[model samples]
Target: MRPAYKQILEAVVVTAELTGSELSAHAQEVMVDDLMAYPLDAVLQALTRCRKELKGRLTLAAILDRLDDGRPGADEAWGVVARALGDESETVVWTEEMAAAAAPARELMMLGDKVGARMAFRDAYERIVSDARSERRSVTWRVSPGSDAERRVAAIVRAVELGRLPAAQAQLLLPTQAVAERHLLLTGSVMTEQERRAGREHVKKLLGMLRGGKVQVARTAG
Candidate 1:
């Protein structure tokens, strides 16, 4: 453990007024080991949040919950998956946990059991998220493109705007003309017909790669 972490943990312990055997050297070592997986800044912020909000004894679980780790709650994750299920032409940017839970949910949805699919998705998502958090795995966001070109462009743009996708990487998933057009529009310029044709060819290649599973869009670390 870093000296800084040890100092912060001791500070948190004092602020929380934790007494008894909980302040033993062995217990502190265990806490440091568990917290070492997270970033120092995140750990500090979580401890600060715990200092302000915890109503009961400060526990590892409470501090973990307070970390801004970017993992969405089960209900929020389900909502994203459920929207994708309803729209075949909707592009989605999701975490690995959401994708993993989505498989079983999609299977149930295919059988016309929407309710069952939702319940299963929530349960699986929670379990997967818990395991991921325990393992100190950060969220990785990936794009799953849809068939609609316009919608795909819109989704990618929105993701980049929201900081869910990096702008540089999003360019790989978009057509050349789409990017050019957006740039031109922002600069009050226009795209030529030749440029449009070139963009179409780029789109075709992207679509082909997507079909072949050769285009693994960039993964954003959360």
Candidate 2:
């Protein structure tokens, strides 16, 4: 093990011991070996989260679960793709794994097999994400700008608001229009400031409902 990694793992082991989950020397070695594949920063963060949130024994699996690499699960990935399919003019910002897995799913959709597409997408996405996580690859978000010139800004702005894209990078992607007018260009429809606030609040409520599992996935294809 590298000196830095060894030091961090030793600290982690000591912390685990204090939490009543003592690890044998051999077990510690094995854990270090497994974790060496991930970035040191990710491991450090995972250890911090595990220390605070984990009630049970600290194990490799538990640390791995806490590694927040910003990669979405199969279901969320599929949801993004499904929403994109609803409008050909819709811009999409997605991770590399999502784009790769989307290829076969798009082909399946073109052949009029939405169900098969969803199944294939889920399986391929899960596998891709797993391999990516194992290699400690950071999720790379890419933007696919649609043909609709007017909607591009709105999409990029939404991506920035959702924390999927950096604001500085988004500025480069946006058109020459001033940043002050972004709210006015949210959609084709014109709305007052009050209406915009209401719309934002409504969206927040819907997102909360979705996160709480109150909203079910529609059976129909987008």
Q: Which ten residues in a row have the lowest lDDT in candidate 2?
A: 177-186
lDDT of each: 0.76, 0.76
Candidate 2 overall Cα lDDT vs. reference?
A: 0.76
Q: Tens digit of lDDT per residue, candidate 2, span 88-136?
A: 8878888999988988898778788889989999988877877787677
Q: How big is the positional error of residue 222 in model 2, measured in Å on the Cα after superposition?
A: 46
Model 1's alpha-carbon lDDT is 0.76
- lDDT by residue for model 1 over 143-218, one digit each (tens)? 8888788888887878777778776678778754475646543444566788767767877887787766643443
lDDT of model 1, residue 76: 83
Give me the displacement of residue 135 in model 2, in angstroms. Answer: 1.1
